[model samples]
Target chain A: MHIEVVANIGEARSDDLLHKTVIVVDVLRATSTIITALANGCKAIVPVETVMKAKEQVQEGDLLGGERYCKKIPGFDFGNSPLEYTREAVQGKRIILTTTNGTRGIQKSMKADHILAGALLNGRACAQAAIALKKDTVILCAGTQDVFSFEDGICAGLILEELTYTLGEKNVLINDFGLAMRGSYLHSKDRLFETLVSCANGKKMSRSGFHDDLILCAKSNIMDQVPIWEHDQMILLPRSLARSTF
Target chain B: MHIEVVANIGEARSDDLLHKTVIVVDVLRATSTIITALANGCKAIVPVETVMKAKEQVQEGDLLGGERYCKKIPGFDFGNSPLEYTREAVQGKRIILTTTNGTRGIQKSMKADHILAGALLNGRACAQAAIALKKDTVILCAGTQDVFSFEDGICAGLILEELTYTLGEKNVLINDFGLAMRGSYLHSKDRLFETLVSCANGKKMSRSGFHDDLILCAKSNIMDQVPIWEHDQMILLPRSLARSTF
Candidate 1:
């Protein structure tokens, strides 16, 4: 029942998250994109580490959805924005997803016994699911290029708060970085998104004109569908697929 | 000034810590060894990444001090424990040091414009020296093999606390992780030393009978002579020859 939220997949790996139930978050778009795609009825999301891998993995029926620097790859089917993962376009189809940070994060977590995709969009659902699973959980924020990202930290805080709220504090074992993320979120709850954009990773995304994507990605608990990773594939969970999933 | 505490040397590199002044901490003994060697009156500490390089670099005048794990190597002059760095032994002597974690961390911070050694024993001095330099600082925790170690996090918290107290909150840019380490210290202040031994790295040390080393390493603010990196060598500050530097 311990909860550890590392700054990124790198930090998560350093924390020895292999045997733990890991929840990977890339709020700026990977997790959000995958969550949105799944919520819209996409069958399953296949996350690949690199764009080259994504391109090679896609079959005739699968679509490529990812970005290099928050922009769509030239030949990919769609960009990394969640707005691109709509019901009409992605319904009932498999997607080969890759991104600069997110997919590589998932690939790193491939060794975890349980790897769950998490984001502010589906944060609550993800937390509740982790709590229900009732094991030690490691929240891995897929930070921008292994550096700390305010967006990822904020989203990790939301997940920490949610998990702690649901599971109680005694069950939590937060690392120093995780504690700071929770404190940052609680202290700046009102301006989390705006303040986040000023951080190192946030500024990079803003300069890339992906600020709008931040708005979409930062809305806490907006989406109820928790994208759970099972057997190396990301699929909609029972909670996310239930009648009240919307 | 922005102050970030990366959990490991690897994270420090990924975060582009080269742009800032880096305070490297390997609390379980590398920094402790350096601090002790200096405290014991050692002239300078030459940090090398690997044992082979450390062995290769020492000359006729320099003494070699370091360890691979808890055990001292067969031919090495000393173990990593600070207690072994007695004043009579190290006085005015140069020590070529390498350890499993600490020396590697110092080598990693070679990319940084300015690098200083940090430990719980010298946390205040390290913070004050970094602030005196008036540069953005990054506290690089040399966590055990790239993972978050509780002892290093606590030491980082001690540095952050010292910095915030001396420089005021407005003068520091506290990242989410930094804030968390501060919170962690506050939450467990009464039993800080007890908490340290319970950590992953600390327990291993305890089990290996180096528990005394942990206690020695955990003492806070014992010295005022902060060691700084100059010309790839860690020496006491102030370029004056008359200064009683180790």
Candidate 2:
């Protein structure tokens, strides 16, 4: 029941992931987009490491949506925007995602015993899903270009706080960075979005006019469906599990 | 400054380490051994990745010490025990040290702009050294057998805490795992050794009769020198510069 937090996907590997339940967090956009698409009724999302691989993975009918530098690639049906994923646009369709960070992050955890997509949008659900598995958990935050991102760390804090509430303190294990995030959350609860926009990685996105994306990521508990990775496809669960019952 | 916490040497090879200050920690023994050797008046220590390479690296007059599976390899002058690094035995002598984990951890940071060894014995010193450089730092924990180790996590926490005290709250950056370690330190400050021994990796080591090693590792402030890797050698400093004067 010990929970471990790794700095980023680059810090985790296939062997290190063995026998551990993994919750992947990419709060800026990729994880949010995956959660939004699946919550809106998409069948599945296939995540790939590179744009070229994702293009080849998509068949004639599957929709492609991802970004390289926070913008949509030419011919991509959509960029890494939660707003682009709606019931009308993504329902009953398949998405081949290849974001610069998130998809690569997911690919790195391909060997995880249990992999779940997490973001501030579905922070509660991710924690709930982890508690349901009844195993030690490892939370891997997809940091920005291998650097710590306040947005992702804050989202991980939300999960850590929720999991601690549900699973009890004894079952919880966090690293120094995780504790700092929880501390940051407490210090900036009244100005969460403002805090998100102030981080180094967050400011980079802001300068590129992605303030709307930051706002979308700031909203918490917008979705309850846990996006679980099974085989090579990322899928969603209908009902959330409560750790108290487990 | 940003602080990245890596899980192991294997995962630390990502492109992010370039141009960044790297502080490597193998607190169980490698780092502690290096710190102890330097503090006890050893001339220099050459760290190597494997036992075969370690033997090859030693010169005619230098002593070799290494271990595998918690036992000393045959023909080495000593095993991977800090207690063996006595001032009378190692004074002014060149030592070539290798171990199952620690040396590999140091070698992995060869690409880093600045590399230093970190341990609870020298945690404050390591942080001070990083802060004096006035650059972002990455804390690479060389956990046991390429998996997360509780002892290393807590040691990294102490370093993070020291950094936070010296740098302003916003100036210091930590990943999710780093945050979690800080939380563990606060929650289990009184029984740091007991808590670590109860962890999965620690339990395994104790079961294998390495409990004494764990006890030695829990001690703090034994060495005041900061061991920095410069020009392919680990050199000790008077005191770390990252600490606050106040």
Candidate 3:
């Protein structure tokens, strides 16, 4: 299997993503929030590129969830925080989500054969989901404003590490960027929270009072569910179906 | 002290580099060769972006050196290999040099306050030179064909680690990409040659009979000299002058 880890959405070519499984990672909030919502029983997440599109996609029963610049969109149920995506708040509801980078990444990967939302919370599960899909993979780190972000790169490293572990090192062929990310992940795995805290977004979010979010997103493999794109919405990959495909 | 580690030439913005000290790294050979040539008593290296420019710049006593697709240009004096630039061949002689990526990187960084050639062999010296220049630094990894390469990224990491060690962590402010590279460098410092051999360019160079070059380029901080852009060419920074700036 071949894995190419793109540094940011700006560097990702849609043509390269074609016929491949693209894992979109936004650990500073987007993908992490998606994974959290799904794991906490959100029915589905419709990720759109713009706030207006997210509003248009919403139906009577659906919840509008997203952020613009790390703040909750006006009249939306929540910001881009996993902690806000509790079982009591999101259970059995569909969410129309739009954020700065993560949703834009998913939109850019529309041509991919499979689009899986990946974060540290579900890194191993995302790797397994890609394996089950049986396509060359592209891990797109949804960096901030087209610049590479440490949290997303770290999440990409976690998924690449998981893929290498499950597929065996010899069976996996990773691009140089992925290889660097894997090394970065291995070096910082022991102090993930501290690592996240040291990055730009981490410091921004911490100053903005999202310290708990950093702690939540820094934990690896805490959730076994993977959110996969299907029919214009992201839903959990059925556990039994994923296992049987292995 | 602020530092930005750009993944490739394509991603570097000229405005961000203005007034900053830029260290251009191409560890698969470009900067490494330049460092070796200067350390071996080469007078100066004029880095150009094209074969025609290299030829045009050559004087009566100048040596023409460059590579096209990892092979020596048909009639050049040497290829992009440090070993080929022996003291007997390059002593007190100017060289007109061009390569696929590294020269392009230096060309792109013309707006910077100072531009220095950096590779694993001279990473520490390059870091010290940047400190002596007393400007915010940008480590531009001259990746292959606008994509990130492991060797260059590792060299950037090595330099970042050196800067952090000398300046102290609290005083040195690094961007997220630089942080990732520093982590990667720390992780693979013990087995750099193996790490390089596993990367794409490394594998290509090894298969093309440049195995020795890989071994030579993988050694960290082997050279105590740095090549800085002065006037229109790259020359060794005077050790006394650099020390005096400190």
Q: Every prediction's TM-score for the first chain?
A: 0.90, 0.92, 0.96
Q: Which ten residues in a row have the lowest lDDT in candidate 2 chain A?
A: A237-246
**Residue A204 error, candidate 2, Å:** 3.1
Q: Candidate 3: which pairs clash?
A: none
Docking class of 1: incorrect
Fold similarity of candidate 3's chain A to the true chain A, as a TM-score: 0.96
Candidate 2 local lDDT, A121-195, one digit each (tens)? 888888888878877787888886775566777787788888888778776766544554554454455667886
Question: What would the per-residue lDDT of candidate 2 be over residues B1-246, giving only the tens digit for each residue?
Answer: 988777566667746777788888887778988888888999888888788888778888899988877788899888888888899988998888886677777777777788888888878778878888777888998877676666777777788888898787778767655665565455555666786676665676688887877787777655668788876778775453544232
Residue-level lDDT of model 3, residues A1-246, one tens digit each, is: 999999999888899999999999999888999999999999999887788998889999999988876778999998888999999999999999887688789889999999999999889888888898899999999999898999898999999998898899999999999999999999999999999999999999999999999999999988889898999899998986455222
Q: In model 2 chain B, where is the ten-residue run with the lowest total lDDT?
A: B237-246
TM-scores for every candidate against the unseen true structure:
0.68, 0.68, 0.97
- Name the top TM-score candidate: 3
Best model number under lDDT:
3
Which 10-residue span in candidate 1 chain B carries the lowest summed lDDT?
Answer: B237-246
User: Interface RMSD, candidate 3?
Assistant: 0.4
